[model samples]
Target: MPDSSAVHFTNAFDIRSVGCSGDPTMFEAFWRETGDAAELVIPGWQTMSYFSDVGNVCWFMEPLFDQQVRRLHRTVGNAAVDGYHVLVGTGSTQLFMAALYALSPADADQPTSVVSTAPYYSSYPAVTDFLRSGLFRWAGDANSFVGDSYIELVCSPNNPDGAIRDAVLSSGAGKAVHDLAYYWPQYTPITRRADHDIMLFTVSKSTGHAGTRIGWALVKDREVARRMTKFVELNTIGVSKDSQLRAAKVLGAVSDGYDVGGGGASRHRLFDFGRRKMVERWRMLREAAAASGAFSLPAETSGQCNFANETAANNPAFAWLRCDREDVEDCAGFLRGHKILTRSGNQFGADPRYVRVSMLDRDDAYDIFISRLASLK
Candidate 1:
């Protein structure tokens, strides 16, 4: 198999690949400007308490990190964190599992079903079912399921396809968890403030710092917050104090870029930089797709962006591409044959005609992808 598992740099950075990696070029410049803002000497004796709070909800979460989270939300105007308890995790994935644990009926004898709409994040089924947890089980698509004792995951500005979504099951017994990972201004318009009982956010998507592994949840109920915290406590004991500290600094820098906007070398803000790159990449992708006549893409949508102070459209993180040629049975496999890599639609519980392509790779890989795609007959 030519060691396809590993990336081999031959003639170019391969565009045939995974779901992530938005260009980090701007983030590099951001750090060069703001890296020193939250310097921590980490005295060997500090954070030895193994706790940031006794309550366990924010146990390993640094207080300053908490403050920065609040400040950043205020600056962005995307989410409302006031009166909401923040639960920190290694990443939103942990918080997601914790939400399932908290929402599932503790008294139920059988596992409570957890679900989302079709074309859900590909990993949800595997992650939810992996444990076969007595507390919860992965039930596909909320639209089909007719049972109670269910927890619905709502990924606004959803994965695989970028459509905004809400709880379809409206059953009195169903509880909804909003995954707002891509609700930030860079990916979508901040049309309104989200005040959900359980909401997840991640630095990986928000600020292009996936390697840091820091994510948080906003909980409206104290009991649910406590339960989610207990799951986190048992899962990792506590999130890394070091990571929390670094994230606080990075988040603070992001807020600064938004708040204190002045022209020149220091003018680059995280969201602005990300939005610009994404907009340009989307334009090019659309152009290539139209030229190819071999592929079809999602319809474009636009709205009034409250944060950007102008009308704008959503720029999805991943491109949901479908092969236009009826001869192609599987879009992902067809792309593979063309030396392009893509995730199959079946992973998201969709048909084989559709595939998912990351629109966030570097220039060379993206250019190669566009050229090859446009050349397709």
Candidate 2:
């Protein structure tokens, strides 16, 4: 595997790719540093029981998982973990839907309107409407939403655009669920301790371990947590014990790196590693976008990072690119015609001139994307 630096490769897939969780191979060095310590040699009989422990509601969560989550939180000073119930899910997606279910009134006259600002995560509307559940339905932007009862899905820094955001609808009946998958120190500053009512995070974006299929939510309301937990129980009974264990080990390993003061050969801090890689990638992207006169990128966003002890800008998980040239009607289609695939801005409730390009591909593929984007007329 190549270093964390995006490896340069030649292929159709290389140019076609420009999207999420990143290539895990980038973490080859970091994982190898953990060595056999992360290895869990579970005997056949060990996991036969459904319970991971005696007192836990669901038995799959090892105590270490919760502890490490708190440890990492305190270490990074990103989001609050204390006074909150941490519920695990297959990924943030399950929790996202679960929050909507939990927030919507079951006995209401109609399903609660779920909404977010435009250029939102494309998946929000798709997932909410796909099941066509009676509990809640996908409502467009919160800005224009006139309803009194609603669940506002707030993604900060917002996906597709990476803009830091707050709940737009201030109605008394409105409740907000914060999708904080990209709120880590690597992508954005440890701005303030996020202590929202319901905040969702994923291991995928945090550590580039998207395949683990593990995510967690921090909920303040016990009843809300109970309902969300019930939703998971009905959806899949519970999350994967194996995956949770692996995630615990991975997260613990990440914490250990930072705990050791981040230096020398062994203590390679995960956040530091991730932040550096992202900043460099963003620099390359900006240059590429600048070279291409037909395209425009979002203005850089920076703030004082408490973790890094320096001012840092957001190097978001994805790049929101706008086609500035008059010739391009649908930016995504234009890129696709040029052998590149991107999520169109319209999917996020924006115009056809906008496109979301993933910044998580391996270095080689990213290099190709930048080159192709720069050369595109």
Candidate 3:
């Protein structure tokens, strides 16, 4: 098999409409080279039952799925799972809501305030208030929020800006849910093993399997796990067992590539492939920004990645581009006029001069985007 890490970029660019929804389809090439390492073929007769484990709090969680989740975490050294209870969700979005439901007080007179730092995940506020649930309400930026009771979302390598973050609110009454979705070595360096009270992760970001719609949460408290499980039970009954099994196979395959006893000669290491692509893409983006002269990007940051055992740059999944041109106040609009779609910074509670561009699109779309961006004066 050809080395998945070595990708060839052609000068040929296709001028087509691009949609940047954090869809991670770039990893398709890498997975394609892995043969059947991540493939799954589940018989129809299997996974027919609604129940997976009745004795466990998360009764719907398949054992193999649970095992693979922990195994991959252990192999990557990105999260601590020794004492955590893993709860599966339809997606991390469901688990995120579950965290809000589990953390908020049921007897409180007012809705629990949910806040994250400005330039937070656009979905956090939208998802929190969509139901208008009395349990929790979107409370804007955590930096300005003055409350004793709140659930703070700490998305490290934050969605819009990709900054390493922690809970902004430090009140004793405030609880934190760490969204470590992009903590994988590909996007950012694994500086430490994350050990938070409630942590959210998804196959979408981690393994680039967004179609699977599989996400899981690690809860330090059994009661919290039970409540989160209850939220999933009420919301979706249970996550799809087929998706879970496929996710398990994918995750296990990832671990296999690194295991000394298993597939030692395997050329399917996902992180190696991912890091190479991200680094190259970031280099291209920086060059584009420099060539444009009207655009700027966050200074590249680097750290000692424990997983890679070397200092590595934080090549974020999203490029937070700022249009410095005096006439352009809305970067998204400016990019939209150029046929390069991106999420506006205003939606992330920041200045309109900035926009969040997905760095994980297919080669043709990304090539077109960078080319268009570079041509802008």
Candidate 4:
């Protein structure tokens, strides 16, 4: 609960930290500043039932959570919700698996091929093949993948690299699942309302409530949504109702902060606070990368953000840092030797010279990381 604004670091760097995981602890300060806006209280007797809205395809999904999901989309103009079926999951990870299960053919002679562009999210391969399911198999990068039947994952403002992306394969026989977890105004500009067939999002990335363990998907087809819901049913019976309610409260609070009539617009807004923090962090990171002179980051990119009503830069949740030192072949190993833990780009189907650094750690850890990175020779 340390306020990021209050933490300061000197020339001396004493802290060594792990920022390999995209844990969004940076937004803790903003929620704390909001006081009781996002606070939730449920009666002990409530949420005891295993069923919620049995009429819906995702029977366990809370209606309030569903409503807030649409409302938030409308408020931010980040994704198209109209005519989309809102499906809930434990987190975006569960929904991601659901997309694979829902998209894969049951009668295929071979396991359906799943793919993404190079330098993709590392979890895309790990999670796809973890169960060793015969229904689908990870088929490496989409750029090199050659097949008619496939499921391509398009992560916009993609993880690890933050590149705005689209489906690499346009085969009519292939289905694409858009992972827009970081499409919020904080990470990238809302250039247009995303209307992909299957779009996955989570409270973890949007509101930095990773512990809430709640994610919702917007599916255009009823049958696909039904199949995705079945995947959730088979995976965990159903997601936690308490978590759904809590997520609903948090999302509602976010939309409320932007309500013009509610007068909450004058108060601290989540996206505003988030965007400010990310912009500042990206600036610091750029400065550090320059000072080190041994690393290079993606060039800054910006677009007119429909939500923020201004041009915004792509401030990804992770930094795709490439080591420029000719002697260093493995950037991750070099950083690890310096007591900085990061995921190597090789895991993302990219070069070993590059590493993905999490930009969402706590303020103290982030400051120490920036200092250490700047001092790296």
The sequence of per-residue lDDT tens digits that candidate 1 reaches over residues 1-377 is 37653445442355433323343333454455655654557778776777787754667778988888888888888889989999898988899998999998889988998889989998789889998898898989888898876999999999879998887887787899999989998888999988988999998788877778899999999999989988988999989888888888888877877675542224547788778888998999999998999988999898889889999889998889999898998998888787788888899989889988877665666778778888887
TM-score of 2: 0.92
Q: Which stretches of candidate 3 lie over 4 Å from their true place?
A: 1-17, 261-265
Error of 2 at 152 (Å): 0.3
Give all candidates' CA lDDT scores.
0.82, 0.82, 0.91, 0.92
lDDT of 2 by residue, 1-377 (tens): 56433354444354436543233445554556767656777677655655665565434566777777787788888899888988888988999988988898889999999999998998999899998898899989988899799999999998979999999988898899999998998899988989999999888888878888989988899899888888987898788888888888888777777675554224557888888888998999898888888889999979999988999998888889999989789998988887677888888899989998888777667787888888987
Q: Show the colliding residue pairs in model 4.
A: none
Candidates' RMSD to native: 3.4, 4.3, 5.3, 4.1
User: Which residue pairs in candidate 3 have backbone atoms (N, alpha carbon, C) closer than 3 angstroms, thus clashing?
Assistant: none
Error of 1 at 1 (Å): 23
Local error of candidate 2 at 81, Å? 1.3
Clashing pairs in 2: 6-363, 7-363, 7-364, 8-364, 18-358, 19-358, 52-59
Candidate 1: which pairs clash? 16-341, 52-59
C-alpha TM-score for every candidate: 0.91, 0.92, 0.95, 0.95
Report backbone clashes per prediction: 2, 7, 0, 0
lDDT of 3 at 113: 94
Q: What is the model-wide C-alpha lDDT for candidate 4?
A: 0.92
| lDDT assessment of candidate 2 | 0.82
- Give candidate 1 regions above 4 Å deviation: 1-7, 15-45, 260-266
